[model samples]
Target: MNWLILVIAGLFEVGFTTCLKLSDNFTNFKWSAGFFICISLSFYLLNKAIQTIPLGTAYAVWTGIGAVGTVLMGIFFYKEPSDFLRLLFIFLLIGSIIGLKIVSE
Candidate 1:
């Protein structure tokens, strides 16, 4: 389904963000390559998804997924701060994503 593809694309967005951090200004060949690959795939999939889905909806969902995923990844792997307010906002973002999914055609 298109929704599934969109979700996958959003996941790749997370991957690209992680690789971007690991790339160290693109000085690291492996992570830089990973960043390019993930970003390319993410864009390709997003293009595919937007063919049918509304642009605003797809964009919002895509960025929402990326934001939530990146935050979680930073918290878990990079030992980023995980304060209550941050977590609360993440949960709110998640709920908004889900609501968008439910309301979208």
Candidate 2:
């Protein structure tokens, strides 16, 4: 469904962002390619989802998922900081995303 596509798009957003970092300013060819491909696909799917979902809701959810996933990826793979306040805000972002979905329905 559209929601599934939106979720996949959001996941692709995370992937593209991570690949962007790994690309090292586009110096790494493989990661850079991945970054471009994932971003294209993410946007394509997001555009598809917006046909049904409200623009504001879809955009917020998309960015929320991307932000949360990217932060988790940074924490786990890149060994970035994982402090309490950081986690609290991540959860709050999640809550806001969920709230958007609920109110949208």
Query: Which number leads on TM-score?
Result: 1
Q: Count of backbone clashes for each model?
A: 0, 0
> For candidate 1, lDDT tens digit of each residue in 1-105?
989999999999999999999999999999999999999999999999999999899999999999999999999999999999999999999999999999999
Q: How do the residues 1-105 of candidate 2 rate in per-residue lDDT, one tens digit apiece?
A: 888899999999999999999999999999999999999999999999999999999999999999999999999999999999999999999999899988985
Model 1 TM-score on a 0 to 1 scale: 0.99
Kindly report which residue pairs in candidate 2 clash with one another.
none
- As a TM-score, model 2 comes out at 0.97
The lDDT of model 1 is 0.97
State which candidate has the highest lDDT.
1
* TM-scores of the candidates in the order shown: 0.99, 0.97
Model 2, global lDDT: 0.97
